[model samples]
Target: MAIVKLSATERRRASAFFTCLILALCAWIAITLSNSYDYQVKEVLVFKNSPQKRAFHPLQSDTVTATVKGNGWQMLFSKMNEQNRIIKVDLSKLDSEAYVVVSTQLNAINAEKAVDNEIIAIAPDTLYFDFTNRSDRKVPVQLVKSVNYQQQFTQSGNIVIKPAYVRIIGPSNVIDKIKFWRTDQLTLKNINEDVNTEVNLQAPDEGNVSIYPKTVQVSIPVDEFTEKTIELPVKLVGNVDFYNVKVFPQKVKVTFTTSLNRYADIDEEFFEAQADLNLWRAYGYSSLPVKVTRLPDYCKIVNIEPHNIDFIVKK
Candidate 1:
């Protein structure tokens, strides 16, 4: 290629021509985008004002393609807003009819949509439903948790759930088999103290099923735990012959873990140790096994001194 240098006047003229071309392009775009045109947007369909006497399940998908009449700029913005938009169709007519006309509710649907975008039509214009008898039942709420506690600290008491049950109203055939509803995952990390919070219930899988009071209050009792030891007399059990049996080492130290706050509350009275004498008669064993049968709530037995006891039988 040969290098050619242009005069200053020629360079200015070339620059002016290119700028005019760019201006014309932008003007054309503005003109084209200002005109009204019809466009399409897909929206999720939800039914409201449902018929109370009957439960229904839609035979088709929850999505419907909507034809919208708007200017090009409106189309651009409507499309951007389309991602989270949902169209609520009225199901009141389903009380007597088996199908619903989505277009009949276009005015109501457009009311919730962008003001400039008018919904003119919807594909699959008629929605069919499968109907069944309506029913309701109460089911317990099960909590799902993923908790990581700090070292030497953990949940010390029972977890309490407020409104432990929820009433589910839905198709009889579907709701009859549901045993319980699950709450959303309760997640915690490095928790060293009590938890008092609210968790939403998991969304019902069946669209026809509705749960009342979607959230439940959750309380998790947490604390730091330390070991405590106490001595208690071992009571004899399974003495079928009513014979007086003497057990060596009448008392044993019970070592267990308890939350710091409840350490003093749990003592000899809260614990009971028992030795079953049936082993001597059942299997000719010389010693009886000792077990701490009763323990205070939230306490774990760590060690029982003298797991076995020597016994002497007297008639």
Candidate 2:
């Protein structure tokens, strides 16, 4: 076949014709994408205004498919977004009924979502929940923390929590299972002074439990630490029979580092120095190993004199 080459004028006309065709194709795509269309999207359900009289548990998973009506532009963007939409369902009517009709709450739900993306309907449009006996229990609060203290500064005494126990009200089964609630982690770095603040407890999980006074006041005593020494008489332990046990140097010097606030509060009575007699009887040891069985809180032992003591047993 012979090749057909166009003249300069013919080439220009062909180029213009192809450009118009391309522009027309682009216009069609723009018009189509700008039109509104109905689409489906997934939404996570969150129940609010729970009935006060009944303790309830959802019968189905919180996710539901929603029919949405919006422009193609928004429809395209929704697919690209990795996050699923969330719809808050009002459960106030559960006081009189066991099921919640989500359609009735559409006006309120729409207010929570994007204005342009109108939700048409939802699959499994009605939500059902199981009811149980509502009960309230008072549970202790445990503090979770990560602390770094300044040099020579540390906690002086026991931490005080105002309202140490929080009242939890929910299903009896859930309340009975919870013995204690933990507060959110409190982080402190380079702390030199006392800490007094309100820390929130971990939020109730799954909406099955509700906590009252969600936050508690935490007071931590902080003070500069200093070394102190005290002399205390050593006592004998593990000698069941009344045997006369004499330990040499009847007393030992207890040197420790304590916070300044607790310096005057702590004394020899706060600690018990004991020599285990079992060391001699069971192992035939020449000396008895001395141990400090009890020490006050927030006090660090620096050194205990006569870690091993020479003793005589008179039976």
Using TM-score as the measure, the top candidate is: 1
Clash count for each candidate, listed in order shown: 0, 0
**What range of 10 consecutive residues in model 2 has the weakest lDDT sum?**
79-88
Cα misplacement distance, residue 27 of candidate 1 (Å): 1.0
Residue by residue across 21-124, what tens digits does model 2's lDDT show?
A: 99999999889989999999888988789998899998888889999988888888896653548898999999999999999999889988755688989988
Instruction: Judging by lDDT against the true structure, name the best candidate.
Output: 1
Candidate 1 TM-score, C-alpha based: 0.85
Mark the regions of model 2 whose C-alpha exceeds 4 Å error after superposition.
1-30, 79-84, 278-286
lDDT scores of the candidates, listed in order: 0.90, 0.89
Model 1 Cα lDDT, one tens digit per residue, 174-254 = 999999999999999999999999999999888888999899999999999999999989999889999988999999888
Clashing pairs in 2: none
Report the error of model 1 at residue 100, Å: 1.1
